[model samples]
Target: MKDSNQEEQRPKTTFSAPVVLPALLGLGALLAFCALYPEQAGRIFPSVQAWVVRQFDWFYTVAVSIFLVFLLLLAVSRFGQIRLGPEDAVPDFTFLSWTAMLFAAGMGIGLMYFGVAEPLQHFLKPPTALGGTPAAAKEALQVTFFHWGFHAWSVYGTMGLVLAYFGFRYNLPLTMRSGLYPILRGRINGPIGHGVDAFALVGTIAGIATTLGYGALQLAAGLHLLTGWNTSTAAFRLGIIVVVVGLAGVSAVSGLDKGVRRLSELNLSLALLLLGFVVITGPTVFLLQALAENVGGYLSSLVDLSLRTFAYEPPREQGWFAGWTILYWAWWISWSPFVGMFIARISRGRTIREFIIGVLLVPTAFNLLWMTAFGNGAIWMDSHVANGALAQTASNVDALLFRFFEYLPATRAASWLAVVLIAIFFVTSADSGAFVVDAIGSRGHPRSPVWQRLFWAMVLGLTAMVLLLSGGLKALQALTLVAALPVTLILLMLCYGLWRGLLADQAHSTQDLAPATSFWSGQHWRRRLEQIVHDSTREDVFRFMQATVLPAMHQVSDELRRRGVLADVQHDLDEGATVRLTIPDPELRDFIYGVRIAHRHLPVFTVQDASEDGRAQVFEPTTFFEDGRQGYDIQYLRMEEVIADILRQYERYRSLSANLRTHLLSRAPGHSEPMS
Candidate 1:
């Protein structure tokens, strides 16, 4: 009975019913309709897709252009220096791990599936240039680079920036609704916010399902070539989905640091190894020359390519335009919430400039190189080695990569290697996608249970399987594109919200006169040195919080109450004891000054604590504010000094509240206390 009571007392995973129920119901209805009426879906989806392309091709073109330009300009602007989290916060993951995870999540499967196919298709049938000519070859690579380059990353970078900026800086839930806080204020906690997250949740599932469907097809094709098995059957793909999704479920259970991180690193290592083999064995010099030429041609033609809708061309080029460029734009936009949110999750503590530049450049550089190695290598191999035989397999999109491998050194081994790489990419995509989906579904609660993540992984696999079985994957892809229209509008609004938030951030920063705990004078030098030198334990800090912090807070609360203000002193005993003084205000942010016990690892040069684990650490009483700013140690200050520090922070808050330009910021919903 006691054990049962303890089990019941454990915290349960909280799901935002507003977000989760609608997303699940909507996805269930869509998949059921597709399963029940596959034939109707088959006919209807294509018409809907074509109609959307014919009508909004220009909107997609222009919207993507705006995203790219906006990101570049923001990176160069003064607001670039703003950190995603507290100013003093450091990055959670190292540069290499962060880059690898993001790259794998962003475009891993697509690169494997399209690297060899896109270039060859364009080379054989150039949209405007004549086929089977040098011009077509250049145009082929140029177009490939354009599609996979800065524009795609910018779409991802924009969403990531919005989520990271609002979620971390404002101490808001890390969900889509947080980005709209400046415009909606507290209404983000209402039905409207739920709707946005629900929309994103449903769209992310479809987008990831589409990518996984493609990955499953390619994996089956690769297995067929290597094992000589009849992998073309629907049962084979179903098996592939089960196996990959099961692996993804395991990864999700292991969480980001263990499973996803290791798999991403391995995925990148294997990809580079394959790329190196091709570079060494294939037409090395020609491919290198083509890569350089491709970059030049892509950059020179970027503006025209960005805006070109093929409006003046005949129906053929227009159709190609709608099929290729427009399709890619829609696909990237639809996938942004998943990729963007994942990026944001891993990108706290980075400055806006660093985040944008890294997101825009790193993965893009690798993608350009990957496409060059596979795309240009295939094109060169077709003309020289295969005598144009490789070109014949272009129509078999799933098997094209394996067919390209057939013309390379150690064809069997390389084919299997590519298969393995694709499978891992499949797992990573599902793993990360499940994580992002669960986050959206839970409205970005940070402590969801492992079972919830596994549930999402299962859902993703089943959705892909159902669609694949019913031949509705294409229809779902089309629906995702239509969904991108509304997402684009939301993204534009997010841009506005982010801009306003940043302006307020800069204004708040400009008002900082001194550190809150910097009032120690030379007369208190002995006390300051004693506090810094002593390796205080948790007990010591708790004593300081009780003796020094609580008294100061109560004094302030007493004075405010006596002045007819509703001020209160609150004490919390959980997760490191805290004492806070709060002054309530309905029109603006409530003024909060808090002191909590914080622990840190002892520096290498410091005296060891000699704990049971042989690890050295120290604890200090630190000051925190209502806004998610970094705190400082206040253990060295006297109680009177602590009161003065609180008043200084309160003055700054009052000044910010009075600024007309920062009205949205002051009135925006703020945290009751700083986030851990």
Candidate 2:
């Protein structure tokens, strides 16, 4: 048996040079330029941002609206029945963990930075209504909800659905290129794929760096508020980045299951605690009434708000629309790849309906309540208690949240808690962003060294620092808005590819005749009973693979070659018990019939004590297929039965290939290969 410690350290994959090299070169070049020429970057970035808004603000608004509508349509369609992975595959993470992680990765920092700043800004300087009026406050919360609500999550949901569908269902690498498989076909394996992934990598870094910039500023401001130590300087912000990124590097090295998950749950808990504290201490009855009114107002105005560009309005209104709404849209788009990839990484095995609904509703619901509590409570305090004091310093957006906490009970503790939450949110965003960037650079290979994650985490921190040094928060937001344009185009193509892929998936399901191996139920009943009772050892499975599985595969391979069909069987070099037979098809997915020894931990009732190596384990020689269908143990099957099974799977593969409707499935590129 292998030591658990050694297994944890074992590397399963390596970087894809085609993706990694260019991405790093590009990132390094940008950072070097920004550090060297701060003035140029400051002017250039905002110019580019203004250009995007002037040229494509309508495009951003329209595309995001479509993404939301697309997801809703999919949820109500037959395609919603399709699972991300194989039909029988169960989710890797539980519902709570999944929600917490997605929430943390998607909007934790943004919410913290904008929760008090946004609503208060809109309230004080009303877009259309007069400032400091009842109508202005209502419109303020409504617009805040609109910006942070369904539209934001839909951008994420669209990217995530594409990745999960192609990556899990079609057995492609979980990278940006995979989402374009149907359109690009095998070209996804070439330079096109490399370029797509490189773009995604750069955009993810910019997005996360932008977010980290927000967190760093807010954290610095909170500390300054708490201790009055002149923490508002660039030096302090850089120090904050270094320390938080260092912590994030540590979390990234600890791996996702251990570090990101735990931190995300902690973030959610602290956020909720702070939220509850505010509601209890603030104008509780008024806040509750505002929550209901805010949700209703948002829902009622959602349609108009989704497509409203204010094109007919004056220049001031147009600028406001661009700076606030357009910028928010672009920020969400640029951040989609990072958040979307993270969500997809955790969302395998869920149905389309479940995935869309969960991704859309869960976070949006929380955001609405949060905006209402913070935004409404702030407005209420401004009117009733502070006499416009909170509104007075809303211009210093970073310190606004802490300022709002001052009028409440336990102001010091609440302020401290908010600071801690921002710090943790910073760490989670950095760590999760590191994981996503690494995945893209590695071409979505499942495993790489911990140092790679640390590398990306450092890259994130450095980028944020450079952006801040170059032009402060404006530079950060500008880069995000600018980076999102190209990514938006890519995501639109992703939508098309996803729709085609889902259609193919539905067609493939329709062509399923029956469970492929259901014909052999009790033909070897006695042998099956023996196999069931016997807890097979690794050596036992190896012997079975060598004696029974190998001969059967060779028999089929020889016959296929006799008929001039390409067939090859290869044994896994690392594991003698694992073997795979491949019959290559040039125009469609290859037919793969593989048998591998799967190690499973024993049930509690079956094991009283584990061996020194760790938990008690059992092994099974399970069959696998190229379509990612759930495999079953074939230990009881005789040599003839194994041969029969191989031929049966090959027939199904050929049959699926012949169906015209499975076009996208036939066009997807092969899985990621080992780096040489």
Candidate 3:
């Protein structure tokens, strides 16, 4: 019974019914479509893709352009210094590991598949420049960089920023609908929230399915290219899907730390080795020169590329833009939920500016280099060695990378390496995507169940296989674009919602800063001064929390309950002995006033020995609020003083919540509290 009570006191997360139903229904539809109606699916998938691309080309173009602009403005805004968690919080992952995960999660597989293909396509038939000319090669690199650069990461960063801010800072569930908390309020736990998450899940499946489609095909191509084994049949592709999905399941079961993170690190190492091989074995100096020029050309043409629509150009060039640039934007937007939430999960304590800048710039630098290495290498060999072979066959984009590798030394080894890299990238993406979608399905429960992870892994694989067998890769691509359409609108709302939430936080922070008056102004000040001067041990802090803090919290809770407000007291019997008073308001998010004996690095001035100087750490009874903001220590305060502090904090929370309230401002005079 004691263990049961402790378990009840501990924090727990669970799913909502409304979210699960719609998500499963969508999942089932995909499964049934692929398994039951294979032939019809094949024909319908391609037509659907073509129609969306044809009709909504302009919408996708405009939506993506705006996403990039919004990210830049948000980063430069006054809220940049705000940490995603508390004001004093630091980053969880270090810079190097974080950067590696960014590459691994965001663009690893796509870059491998399209690194050579996109650039060569642009070179073969430059939309604006003459084909097979010097200008075309430069334009090819520039265009590839543009598609894969700031806009894509900005879309991802915005989604991540919203989620991380709400989850860590505001105590909302870390999911897509939670980003709309400022707008939806508690309704986010309702049908509307379910709908938002459902869309994200569906989009996640489609986007990853598209990537898997590309991966399986590319893997098959590598196999045939290396050993002359014909792996192009539908049966062969299905086998690859089975193998990738099974591997993803193993990784998913292992969880993030041992599974995804380790794979991501390996992916980076293999990627570096392959990149070095290309840079060393292929056109070494030309690739370097092209990388520098590519950066310059990309900057020069950024705006033109961002906002371009072929109002005056020939229909063919317009078609080209719609086919390529718009498609990439839609693809990125579709993938943002999985990628963004995954990014958010890893980036708990990072500041807003650090996150936006690092997420945008780091992957982009690698993206530019990756494109230049493979893209430039392919172009150089086409012109110098293969005599335009790769450029001519750019139509068959999937196999183009393998063909380009044949021009270099150790063609078989390099081709095999490419296969392994794509396979690992495939597993990383699927495993991560499964984990993310499960979180979405379970209404943002981070540790729902292993079965959910495995279930989604199978769903993701099945979705990709179905698309490949039914509509082929084109079908998967089409579904991605179509699914991303609604999320574009959702993302716009989230931008405004994040801004509103930030304004409230900043206002609360400004108002909540108590005047730095003396906390030791009472008749018992001398006694407390002596206590403060000495090092307080864990037992001492716990005694203070239990005797003084806990009783004070119950007094406030009882008073609020008698005043017709819903109030409760909770005690956590951990090392810190945290105690909290929760006051919930249906019109706004709940307010929690909590305090714990948290550790801090001991003061530098107190250390006598040089070796032991910086190592000592001490505990301080620290106050933490619902908004993830930290407050001053109340360890020395009496019960009356602690109760007073709670009231003051509650008043400040009410004031902040009032400013951000859009609806339900009025209450009936005789109406009681929610509990009352």
Best-fitting candidate, scored by lDDT? 1
lDDT of 2 by residue, 368-468 (tens): 98888899989999999999999889999889999999989999999999999999999999999999999998888886777888888988998898878
lDDT of each: 0.89, 0.88, 0.83
- Candidate 2 backbone collisions, by pair: none
How well is each residue in 1-676 modelled by candidate 3, as lDDT tens digits? 9967865664444556677677768766865775667666667866786677778877877887887787777789888888899878888777877888889999999899899998888888888899889999998888899889998898899899999999999988889999898887888988888889887887787788878988898899888878888898999999999999999999998978778888899999999999999999998988888888999989988988888888789988988887888778878888899999999988889888889999999999999999999988888899999988887888787788899988999998998898899999999999999888887877666557677789889988988887777754565566667777788889989999998999998988787533222333566868777876888777888888988899999988888889899899998867437888898776556788998878776645332643574576777678887666757767678788788888888887777655534223332234443431
Error in Å for residue 217 of model 1: 1.0
Report the Cα lDDT for residue 13, model 2.
53
Which ten residues in a row are the worst by lDDT in model 1? Answer: 603-612
lDDT by residue (tens digit), candidate 1, 625-663? 887789987777788888898888999998998777766
- Cα TM-score per model: 0.76, 0.75, 0.74
Off by over 4 Å in 3: 1-15, 34-55, 512-676
Ranking according to TM-score, highest score first: 1, 2, 3
Q: How close is candidate 3 to the true structure, as a TM-score?
A: 0.74
Candidate 1: clashing pairs of residues: none
The better-scoring model by TM-score among 2 and 3 is 2
